[model samples]
Target: MQIRLAGGRIAAEVHGSGEPLLLFHSLLADRSSFDRITGQLAESFQVIVPDLPGFGASEAVTGGLEPIADRMAEAVRDLKGSHRPIVLGNGFGAFVALQMVIRHPGLVSRLVLADCGACFSEQGREAFRTMAAVSSAKGLSALSETAMRRLFAPDFQAAHPELMQERLAAFLRTDPAVFRAACEALAGLDLRPDLTKVDVPVLVLVGEQDEATPPAMSRELAAGLPDARLMILPGCAHVPQLQAPEHFLEATLTFLTNDDTGRDSERVQAVA
Candidate 1:
């Protein structure tokens, strides 16, 4: 489904029933990135997955993360009324989710941040700048290999050649300008100081082998947030949901359904 928000059209996929649960995909990725775990999540909550503006079928919108968050909040209100739904965001989307909570407090009931951190390290920022420059100069094809390396662990990439090619094709199809824009947006992101402001329960999940954000960043995020717990998925990389769907679902569902004070008690079993 597509909804007119602000000045642009936002494309989204809505499924199942019950309380609303919004899923936000990563940079260079569309809503289909969450296809692996959508069915399981939908069984218990209404799943609303949308393509970030400039990424998929969603029309591009102006401004950075703040304006995007505002538009997303508006879309949520329009779709579910006064309902404050649970939000799950990965990679760039996680940054947007954090922006949403900070910009519009009480907009999200609970938060699940996956493969994201409070802020990028200096080296990470440099990498993003390089990505933007490369994409702008050489186009999306030039970014395919680097993007895959940053997204999946070496073992997974080696084992799943078919899936790797599939993702590469998708990445190649993305508009280089949009990819560069996203890289620039990420280069400017810094949410460390604002972490203390987040009062809602949060679940921070990261792949143990994640190279993009890294586990150390996730640790800082968990420590900074007022009420947050960290869970590391073994042998997984940037996109745990894609690389380890069962473990991802178990960790996320357990956290979302748990009534406990969002502590470490609800552990997501590490896959062997």
Candidate 2:
């Protein structure tokens, strides 16, 4: 489950069989956030989920963005062999996925950008800056509860205390320094200029209740892509896969299968 990269070891888990699909977790999350959806996805595709550098069991990165992108692309390449694979990322993970498409176009056959937005703008930069500052001053524990609440609708959280606690625990498991680094990376990211360079088919999924990135931002990202589709999931928050597993799975499977309509009969009904 661990591969030695140039500067560190990348902890990645592989499951199922068939076409390869790579998963990237959100800013404060690791591969385990997708645990509820992975089993179902693995039934049809080979799901490769990695705990990004500085998060979970993955080693920290000594270099910056360029090296980070190269390392992630390399990880994907190692997982998929010669054939380009579908790359999917949620939240911060989506940002990295977009970078992969732009920085290593030939390595990705398709993209699934969930709960992320256009980072090529002042507002996007500001969000990252805010996260960086907060992480540096307050640490991951201070932001854990708020982060969880922000990822879901008001009623959703009230109904899912156990789920929120589980996720918050994961987010808090990382070292404070590592969390701060992630925030700084987010603040420094702005890939608007490179969006046009991405030629692969893309699917952008947004949560209707997502205030962090908002739905409009996701729309803008979809508009910038060459061949892309946008789907807004109702009654969901920042982490739709965790907030509404069935809808998230439908949107994801539809995108991966090349269904332009964003509709799939098969749905993951329950969370793991």
Model 2 error, position 71 (Å): 0.8
lDDT of 1 by residue, 118-160 (tens): 8899999999999999887887788788999988977799999
Provide backbone clash counts, one per model: 0, 0
At residue 165, candidate 2 shows an lDDT of 81
Q: What are the per-residue Cα lDDT tens digits for candidate 2 across 1-272?
A: 44443334777788887788888988766688898899999999888888777777677775555666677887876663656788889987888788767888788888889888656356656765676677787776767666776677779988988987887887788777766666676667667678889877878888888877788788778777767777889888888888788889987886677545332322212222
TM-score of 1: 0.93
Which candidate comes out best when scored by TM-score? 1
Worst 10 residues of 1 by lDDT: 263-272
Position 109, candidate 1: lDDT? 88
After superposition, which runs of candidate 2 have C-alpha atoms over 4 Å from their true positions? 1-8, 80-82, 120-124, 259-272
Reference-based lDDT, residue 50, model 1: 84
* Pairs that clash in candidate 2: none
CA lDDT of each prediction against the hidden true structure: 0.83, 0.76
Candidate 2 vs. true structure, TM-score: 0.88
